[model samples]
Target chain A: MSESYEATVTDPVSAPMTCDSNPVEEWLRMDRMPHIWCPGCGIGTSVNCFTRAIEESSLDRKNIAIVSGIGCTGRVAGYLLLDSFHTTHGRALPFATGLKLASPKTKVVVYSGDGDLFAIGGNHFIHAARRNLDMTVLCVNNFNYGMTGGQVAPTTPEFAIASTTPYGSVERPFNLPYLAQSCGAVYVARWTVYHVKQLQRSIREALEKPGFTFIEMVAPCPTLFVRRNRLGDGLAALESYEENAVIKNGADTRECDLGMGGPIVCGKFVDIDRPSYLSNQVAHLRKVLGDRYVMPDAWQGVVQ
Target chain B: MNADPRGVLTGSHFLDGDHAAAEGALAAGANFSAGYPITPSTEVVERLAGRFPFTGGTFIQMEDELAASIAIQGAVWGGSKALTVTSGPGFSLMMEHLGYGIMTETPFVLVDVQRGGPSTGLPTMPAQADMMQARWGSHGDYEIIALAPSSPQECFNLMIRAFNLSEKYRTPVLLMMDECVGHMLERVVIPSPEKIQIEPRRYTRKGPDEQYWPYSLEECNNGDLVPPLTKVGEGHFPHITGLTHDDRGYPAMNAKSQAVLLGRLVDKIRNNADDIITIEEDGTDDADVIVVSYGITARVCQPAISRARAEGHKVGFLRLVTVWPFPEKRIRELAGRVSAFVVPEMNLGQIVREVERCSQGRPKVRGVTHAGGAVHDPEEIYNAIREVMG
Candidate 1:
């Protein structure tokens, strides 16, 4: 609706377009676009899938809140037409935890990047999972700190070239799915940006499930990660994913690690039910206090 | 508004400063507290953990102080009155989130039970070293309000005041209690809920269809600079960020935006210093010398001031109940009248600098500084007062 956005869409040389509506426009802050993402960056694609998943889920759109930390993918919260919080670096998980606990019925999602979540926010991630807090954690693993111009990250593949790791990364990358499962995440999944439909479906499934749900979207940083590592462009990265990616449901998360230029194992590796943090707290309190037990006002409507 | 009766204990009980503070927070309608355990401050959360179950509240022991600090801010946005308690080292970890809370204008209480520090100096001993840190620890040009309580009763009374002030201003308030005050057991009377005054959260009345901006000047009342808050999950769909932002709460990323945002953040407390400041004074009407102190040092200065007064030295006592605004006006007024001002604190002269700055070289200002691990000796403070008089 802004003049700048309209200016971008109207090209005098192009054929007259008849399409009047975009399906995702209803879920986006159209006025804020022209976003800052570089061309061929897969963060936009991942966001599209996420918005589609939210549309397909049973959650009330007004009741859904999204929180993000400092990164390129962290901008997703700002773009979304929902209650959004752009918090400090590596602090989104704990912020979302407070939001979810304070308003139990509200569906909270923490969306950030690998460097922001795994590298700096790893402690929060593990603790949030271990407590089985009810929230969805969607991480875009671009293998480098894209916003900070391609510094080395925790999800960066071993022996991969980066701004910091010019010779090669000597440290091992985290198998995120395995870490999520080990930390008691009830639902864990990973999908590349190339697998749009599958990623959308996985997100929808995670949104519906209870307890700590984590999905890692292995996106391409065309300007930074791909360029520095000689991995061609974003299109080439997608093409490589098409050729080397294996979709194996119920795969062992520990074996899903990716080496440089290796096969990317992607699937929903963990899905089991467990009592969430609030439920467990309520149950324990009810047993101890008997008739004196009172559910917190925030949890009253949902828990009873 | 009167507090909720369910949270009020409604009777007299012997309590430590920490327990009294916990009771005060609950009575002030703090239904959520996320804190990591640290020395001296651990008792506050331990009491909340035991009491929140019956009071229909939630207390989460977070993984660390960093998580605990920001988690409380999230809870505030989620439509809950919240707080987080910590000691010296943990308070250091919370500095970043304190800035975050200030930038977003999130109303919450951060109770810092002060202990020895620089880096974990003495976890079990008292120190007022964090006085400067409480005011300027966060990175940026912003202002915050801090209170110091010297007794269990003040802890109970001032914790409620702290939350009220936070809600009134829509900013984080610090209850700065040293280890001496936090662990000292004393008589505290929990008044009935109706007797306790509480400031309910200032929630915006705007509906979804209305044009509501979270940080707009339109949202703030004339002369009262705090904008009303909108709860998350409601229809407002507020976009809050730590970046220098416009009235709409979106990042503006420019100097003009930074000036506009930072100006209000600083002015809200500085302009309203008179309404926010609280000080207890005795016999300053005809005194040549004034002894200024806060926290545990204020209690220690009592006997010293009495001894000086008994000798006809005309020494007066001034206790800083609200320390952050520094009671500048009173200091300026008394600075012109008094010949000297003596400040006794557990730190190596943190607040004495403020006193000297406010005095503006008119009065001779002296700091009776002490390192942590113990309270200042009364004789030392008396000697400083006598020397300042000379």
Candidate 2:
């Protein structure tokens, strides 16, 4: 654990909006709280957005499943009252991918963090998107590891101060939106806690969208990223988000080149058509296993 | 060998362990398999993919090990018996969901054709190193049923038992085949469908789904344990999680729920050990020396056992078919009768420790260890048996 530094920090507090509209409170694991997040962290915003999205869609609460990996943000599934899975770090994607495939009728959503998604689970993420497996992936990009004292991660901004990079981070961060789009996310979006209405809207669209849908929520890590950048308290980080974020159209992913000077583009990036993995699998199985199948109701036990 | 007079299955032919495993799963009524190709165990998937379709079942090559595991779970949930095959690397990737299957009590079969490992240690080589990992790798305290096949035909027969135990207990059943049995090609007699007894999944037929609780436990007059399970769309249950949960499947985070759930999950197997565990002993009744072996190593010790006994030495063989929920009582019985127990395995003395643990000082147990792709020479085992006789 790191020492708590005194804040000569004068971070402005954004006006409090209604943050407590959790529709699935009865379904959540309340005792695991207060979640291991820094005070004023935006992961709570993403979790609220997820619960709100699920509520708004009006999907069967019982059929809905939430799978998460190891990280502060990944623990969102633990607190939610759904069929939640807190699996091994960086493994939630594959686990979720499997869960969705096994029970395709069930609504499967993966909630993880940048490190969980883009670092350890990077291969599974890209491949799942490529395969277009039917699932929603909500990645909370907090730029650094919050659970382990804010270490540098794949999404940590360059030249930023983190536990591992005390001098300054020289490694470049991944452009998650562009990478996901190129890998074939039928629906892709990026939003910050700063954009509640827009974030909620993107989430709703993703839920309705077919195939692999990815939403990268740029949450604030006030205890780490913001504290070190002297960016102010967690609430101030959202205020700065409002000031600096450029929410362009989804097509802006093509124009925002990383390694070159350009604003980070955040919006609903891609929505398109593709036959999902499970549907195609079902079609193939139906065709091949047609004559052999005994309909469920009429099935006479296994063939001798 | 001649066909059985009952006409249930053709007699054994010269076949390898891999072929036996595939035919075993087929006989056990495995109709769906979704797995990615991996070494040693790849043949299991390849054979299943070809046979399942012809048998009127589904076979899918999942994107990865993780997806394969989930797909198998789904097939089982869809009311189809399914299985997946993988080795060390793939198995490592599947540890988390393997735990998921255990927690959900989803019945499925996983064939781990053991290979050398830490990372990608030795893929083609033989190793029984995953024995402990198979039981404990998936987090949480839960009982699992694992079987080791000592011969090509045993692989075929044990796989059938694996599925049955998986279905009855509602737990993931592991068929631990080392690279030796996994890669070695041997002919196996295909059992006629008439001879195979297939147990269809037990679904609740209660009226109106509300009365159904998917995980409700039931104890019969004879005190047999059964956990309630219903199909997904059926009105039987609510939520299921990796977390400690109540009977309703809803997440329950109290000690009371944890104690109850964990106990039931484990007790369901422990209480029914007689029905779940199986082993074979050759000349163990009055032997002064015994050889405890399983899977491929047991094959090497087979000839040695016969030779030791032929040489006027009271040497015997104890072959474990059920590796976990281990044949504890039977091992104890053998300990009392035998003077020494010799364990031959293709790994660094893994199951030998189990033999020592089960012997309880009644018999001196020693390990015959080997690693890498090579199997132990029969002569080595023969020598070990002789030394014990002296």
For DockQ, the strongest prediction is 1
Candidate 2 wrong stretches, greater than 4 Å: A1-39, A58-63, A79-81, A254-264, A279-304, B1-16, B26-32, B54-82, B92-106, B116-122, B125-129, B135-143, B185-187, B190-195, B198-268
Q: Across residues B59-128, which tens digit of lDDT does each residue of candidate 1 receive? A: 9999999999999999999999999999999999999999999999999999999998889889999999
In model 1, pairs of residues that clash are none
- The CAPRI class of candidate 2 is incorrect
Docking level for model 1: medium
Best by lDDT: 1
lDDT by residue (tens digit), candidate 2, A129-196: 88887789999988888888889998887788899999878998898888889999998888888888
Chain A TM-scores of each predicted structure, in the order given, are 0.93, 0.86
* C-alpha local distance difference test of each model: 0.91, 0.75
> Tell me, what's the RMSD of every candidate?
3.4, 5.6
